[model samples]
Target: MNYERQPYRRCGRSGLKLPAISLGLWFHFGQERTLHDQRAIIAKALELGITHLDLADRYGPPLGAAEEAFGTIYRKDLRGLRDEIVVSTKGGNPMWDGPYGAGNSRKHLLATLDRSLKRLGLDHVDIYYLHRDDQETPLEEQVATLDHIVRQGKALYVGVSNFTPERTAEAASLLRELGTPLTVHQPQYSLLRRRIEDGLLAVLEEHGVGCVVYSPLAQGLLTDRYLDGIPAGSRAAGGRFLTASDVKPEVVAFVRTLHDLAAERGQSVAQLALAWALRDPRVTSLLVGASSPEQLEGNVAAVDRLGFTDDELAFIDRTAKEAGVLA
Candidate 1:
C-alpha cells in the first residue's frame, strides 16, 4: 500500500474529483467473506489512497449483502472518514421477485434508493447509477426520476451503465434539460471486450459524460495467471462466471503476446491493460475488483508508469488485431 497516486480528474463538467484508480465491491465483498476481511480490504484501499468505493444493491450472492457489508466497514473503519470518500451505488436491477423489484420506473427507482440509503447507513450517496437499461420502460421516465432523486437529496449525482450510445445521449439530454447533468457513464470496457469502441466512447465524449470502465482485465483474461492455462484458484476455473471453455488456445496465445509486451515495458499484463484504458483522458477512473488486498495493490501499480511510446502503441495494435481484440 505504499504506491503513489497520480493526479485525479473531474467527472465530466462536475466539481467532483475522483481518484485515478477506484475500488469496486461488485464481485468479492459479499456474505461469503467475513466482516473483518472485508474491512481489511477497505482499510488497505484507503491507506493506499483509493478514495472511491463503488457498490450496488444487488452485488451480493443473497442480495443487499454488499451494502450491508459496507455499513459494517463504514462504522468500523470509515465513520469519521466518510467525507473523504466518494461512495457510489446503483439500483434498477432486480433484487426481489416482484414486479416492483426492478426497472427504471420512478416507483422502483425512488423506492430502491431509499432502501439502498438505509442499507449503506447514509443519507445520500455521492453518485447513484442505473445498473442497466430497461427497454420496457420509457427513457424519459427513467431520466426524470433520476433527476428527481437528485432534487430530493437522495443522490448527489446520477449515472447510467450498460447503456447504448443512442440511449445514453437521450438520457443525457433529458437530464441536461432539468439542469442535473449526467455525471458519468459506467461501461464494461476492456481489451478483450471492444463493444464500447463501437461509438459508445464517442457518444460519451461528445456529451461530456466521463467514463469509468469496469473489467479492464476482462475478468482475468489479460492477467499472467491465465497465460499458461486456467490455474487453480482463478476466476475461469471457478466454474461460476468465466469458464475454461472461454479460454481458447487463440486467447491464450494472444495473452502470451500481450504479456511479452508488458514485460518489455517492465510491467505486468494487468498493469499494461489498465494503463491502456486510462490513456484516454475521457476515462475518469478504472473500476477494479480484488479478492485480496495484494491483488488490489498490484492492479493500482499500473497507474505509476502509463507512458506508452509510439512503437509500443503500434505493437499493441498489431498484437491486439491478431488476437481479434483491436478489430
Candidate 2:
C-alpha cells in the first residue's frame, strides 16, 4: 500500500490518527455505480493511504445498499486488513418505515447500528455518528444513546453531523460526563460553505473534538468544471443535489478566478478549495468522495501543498464575498 501519500492527523485528543484525506462512501457505493467500480475506488483509496471510510445507513439509493456492498468488499478484499482501517458509519437518518426509523431515540440509534454492523460484516466500528440532530427527540436521550453505543462496544468513538455549535457543545459535555467523549464532528465545509466558520470549529476545538470535514469541493462548484460554464452531463446539469439555479454568473466568475489562483499554486481548483479548508489547524481530516481512482489520486495530491500565503487567503475571502457565498 502507498500509505505515505498523505500525512495523518490525530482525531482530537484520541489516539486515532486519520489520513489527511479520507474516503467517503456517501456517493457511488450503491447501485448508481457497479460493485466492481466501488471496490476499485475503495482499493485505490486504501492503496493511497486513505484509511477512513465514511458511510451512512441511508446513503445508498435503495438504502442500506452502501453498507451491504461494503460488507462484501470487506470480506472479499479487506478482511485481513481491517486492523489498518478506521471504518465509520452513521445512524438516525430514516432508514425504515417506523416512527423510530429516523429519530435519535435509544431504540432507533441502537437498532440502526446493529443493522449497520450486520451489513458491514463487523463486530465494531471505529466511529459512529448521529447523522443528524432530531429536534423532536430529547437531546438528553440522543446523547445518552451515543454513550450507550460506545459502552456496548458497538462504536469505539461517537460523533454528530449537521449539528449546530450549541448542540455540539452540549452533546460533548454530556458525552464527557458519560465517559465516552465525542471524538469527531463531520461538517459540510468548503470555500463556498462557510457556515461552520461561525462557531462549530471553535466548539470542536474547545471540546477537543476533531473535525472530519465533508463536501470540501462544495458539490463540484469549487472545481474548474464550472470555471467556464456548467457543462452538459455535469452535476449542475442533472439538477439534482446541485441545481443549475445554484450556479449564478458571479459564482462562475469566482470559480474562474479561483482556477487561476490554483494554476499559480500548481494545483487544481478543487485542490485549492480543499487545501483552503485544511488551512485551519483545528480540522483533523477531510472526507472526500470520488467517482474514480483518478479523481481520488488528484484529491489526495492536494495534501502536497496545503499551505497558503496571506495574500492568497485574502484574495479568496474577497472573491467569496464578491461572489456572495460567504454564508
Number of the predicted model whose TM-score against the real structure is largest: 2
Q: Residues 1-327, candidate 1, lDDT per residue (tens digit)?
A: 323554578888788888888999978888888887788788888877898899999988679999999987787778898888999999998877788989989989888888989989999999999999999999999999889999999888999999999999999999999999999999998877778888998998888898888888888888888777778988788877789998877778888988888898889999999999888888899999988889888988898888888998888778778877542
By TM-score, how accurate is candidate 2? 0.98
Best by lDDT: 2
Lowest lDDT sum, 10 consecutive residues, model 1, at: 1-10
Cα TM-score of candidate 1: 0.96
lDDT score for candidate 2 against the true structure = 0.90
Cα distance off (Å), candidate 1, residue 216: 0.6
Give the CA lDDT, 0 to 100, for residue 206 in model 1: 86
Q: Please give the CA lDDT of all the candidate structures.
A: 0.87, 0.90
TM-score of each: 0.96, 0.98
